[model samples]
Target chain A: MTNASAQAASPPWDDVSITVIRRDMLRFARMQLRDSGAAEDMVQEALMAAMTSAKSFAGRSAFKTWMFAILRNKIVDHIRASSREICGADLAGSSDMDAGLEEFDVLFNRRGLWNPDDRPATWADPEASFEQDAFWTVFDLCMNKLPEHIARVYTMRELLELDTAEICAELGITRSNCFVILHRARLGLRECLENRWFQGEAR
Target chain B: MKMMNCKDATQLMSERYERTLSLRELLSLKVHTAMCKGCSNYGQHLDVLRQASARLRAGNTSGEP
Candidate 1:
C-alpha cells in the first residue's frame, strides 16, 4: 500500500493493520452489498482511500474503527448510487429460512413461559469496559454465530439504523417479516452475549 | 387487557423496536413483564444489546476502534 509520491514517513497501514481486519471489512461489505465481487471492490476502494489519508491517521483513534468508518462510507455510498431497485438481486442470506430459530424454542416451556432452567440471569453493573477490544471480540463472535439472514436484518435495523419501512423496502420483505427477523436476531444475540460475556464473567 | 404469556411478551418487546405497539399489546407486555422476573431480566438484556448495537455503528463514525 505504498505511494511513490508520498513522503518519507512509513504508511500508516502498519499501525492501522489491515491484514487482520481485512476479513471483517470484507464480511461487512458482503452483508451490505450482498455481492462478493462488489464487496471486494468496495473494500479495495476503501483501502486505497485510507492509504491516501494514511499520514493523517497518527493514531488519533482506534485503527479498526477509523478503517471501518471509511469502509462503511464507501459501502453506503455504493448503495446510494445503486439504490433500492438494483439491490434485490444480490441480497444476503435469504430471509425466510427461520435462521436457526428452533434453538430459541427450548428457552421457553410448553406453557410459553421462560423455562426455569433457561431463565435469563441478572447481569450486574458491567458498564465499565464492554467497549474494549476483548468485549468487542465477544460481541463479534456472538454476532458471527447468528444466522446470516438474522445478522443481515439486525445490521440493517441496528447498525444501519434503518426503520421498519426502510428495512422492509431494502430487503423487499413485509413489515411482519422484518419484525420477525429482527426479533429473532435480538433474541439470539442477547442470549449469546449473556452466555458468552455476562455469564462467563459470573462463572 | 388480555393477559399474555412470557413468550408473547418477549416477542412484543423485540417487535417494539420495529414498530410501536398497539395500546393493548403494550399494556399486556407491561403487565406480563411486571409480574415476570425472567421476562423482566430478558428485557433489560435486550435493552443492553440495543444500546451496544447503536454504539457499535455510532462508534464507527466517531472512530472508537
Candidate 2:
C-alpha cells in the first residue's frame, strides 16, 4: 500500500535503540551540567530533537554520533546560560575543607618523602574492576562525594578532557591555580576510590 | 632541589597527563617509581583512572536503567 511504502522510506527513528546510548549521553550531560536533574532534562530534549528530525537523518554517520551532536549543542547552550554562576563559591570566606590540604602534610614530611604509614597500598586487578558494575557505582558515589568546586574542576579536566586554557577561561582561574585545583581534585578522587573500592575489596 | 619522594613523585604522575615532563622530572619519576612499591601502586591507579575516563569517552554503555 502507499502508507507502507512511505513508512519504509523514512529512517526508523522510533525504532532506534536509545538503550544503546542513554547512559553515555547521561554521563556526557553530567560532565557538562554537573546536575543529574539538568542532565536528564538535556538528554530528553536531545532525544526529542532526534525523533523530530529523524526524516532529515541520511544515515551517513552513526546514529549515536548524530544524537550526540544534538546533545552537545544543548550542553553548549546550557553552559552559556549558566556561565554567570559557574563558580558558585564564596571568595570572601574560607572553608573547613581548605584545612583538608593539611592532611597531605601528614603523608609527606618536610623533605617531601612519604611517611611510613602514609604509603599507597597495592590494588588487586584494577582493570578487572572496570568490568564490575558495583565498582562503577562506588566510583560514581565517590565522584559525588568530592568537594563541590573540586569535583567541578575534576570533571572538566579529566572526564571532559578540556585543555587547561579552556578550563581556566571557563572557571576564571589563573594557570597555576588551575593546576593546583586539578592536583587537589585528582588527589581527592584517588583517595576516595582507593578507600572505597580498592581497599574495600582487599578486605 | 630535594630528592623526589613518594609525595612529589605522585604529584608528578598527575602532572604527566597535563604536559610532557622535563627530562629531569621524567628521570626522577622513573627512578622513584622503580623502587617504591607505594608510588608504583599509585602510578597504576592513575593509569586505571585514565582508562575509566577513556571508557566514558568511548560511550561504552553498561545498560543500567
Candidate 3:
C-alpha cells in the first residue's frame, strides 16, 4: 500500500491528528495574536513544545485543550519578551487610555468561559446575514485602531485563550490592572463595532 | 430596584454573561440585572458582540472567502 493510502486507511484521527490539531492551534494563535506572522511563529513553537513534552501529556484535559494551554503560554511569553522595553512604565501613562478603557477589564477576566454551553442565548446565535468575512474585516479594522499594547493584551487573553493569571504572570501585571485593560478593550471594540456596523440596529 | 451603572455592569458583563463569575459577583450582577434595564441591555449587547465574533471566527476557519 502507498504511504498516503496506508495513512488514510488508519483511523481518521490517527491519519490526520497532527494536522487537525495544528490547524486548531493556528486558528487560536491567529485570534490571540491577530498578526498572521506572529501567530504562525507561536504555533510552530507550541507544536515543537508539545511534541517534545508528549510524555507529559497525562490526558488530564482533552489533547486539544492541553495543547491550547501550551500555545497560550508560548504566545504570552513572546508578547512579554518582545515588549520588555515598556514593562516598567505605567500602563495608564500612554495616550491609549481611551482604547484601554474599553478593553482592559473585559478581556483580562475572560478565562474558563469558552464552552458553547455557557454562552448567553442572545450571543448564542448570530444574525443570518452576518457573514464571517465582513465581521472579520470590521473586527480587524477595529483591532488595528487599538493602541499596540492594549490590542496585544486583549488578543492574548481573549483570542489566544490565556487565563488571566497566566497573562498577569507573563506580562507582569496585577490582577486589577489586567481586568482594567480587558474592560477597556471590550468597551472600545463595542463602540467601534456599533458605530461601524450596528449603528442602525436598536442598540 | 436601581439600575446597574455602566461601570459595574461593564465589570460584570463578561463574567456574568459567560457564567464564569464568582458566586458573589454573579449574585451581585443578577440582583443588579433583575432591576436594571440599562445593565441588562448592556449584557445583551455583549452577547451580540460575542456571537458576532464567533461567527467571524467560524467564517475565517471555513475559508468562505
- Which residue pairs clash within candidate 2? none
Report the lDDT tens digits of candidate 3 across residue range A24-68: 567666666668898788888887888778656655555666677
Off by over 4 Å in 2: A1-16, A53-62, A65-69, A87-106, A115-118, B61-65
**DockQ of candidate 1 compared with the true complex:** 0.40
Better of 1 and 2 by DockQ: 2
Clashes in each model (backbone N, CA, C under 3 Å)? 0, 0, 26
Task: Estimate TM-scores for all models.
Answer: 0.72, 0.80, 0.58
Candidate structures ordered by DockQ, highest first:
2, 1, 3
TM-score of chain A of each: 0.65, 0.74, 0.56
Specify the CAPRI tier of model 1. Answer: acceptable
Please compute and give the TM-score of the first chain of candidate 3 against the native first chain.
0.56
Per-residue CA lDDT of model 2 for B1-65, tens digit only, reads 86787778887898888878899999989988899898898888888788877666555435343
Q: Candidate 2 vs candidate 3: which has greater TM-score?
A: 2
Tens digits of lDDT, candidate 2, A127-163 = 6787777777777777777766677667777656678
Docking class for candidate 3: acceptable
Error of 2 at A132 (Å): 1.7
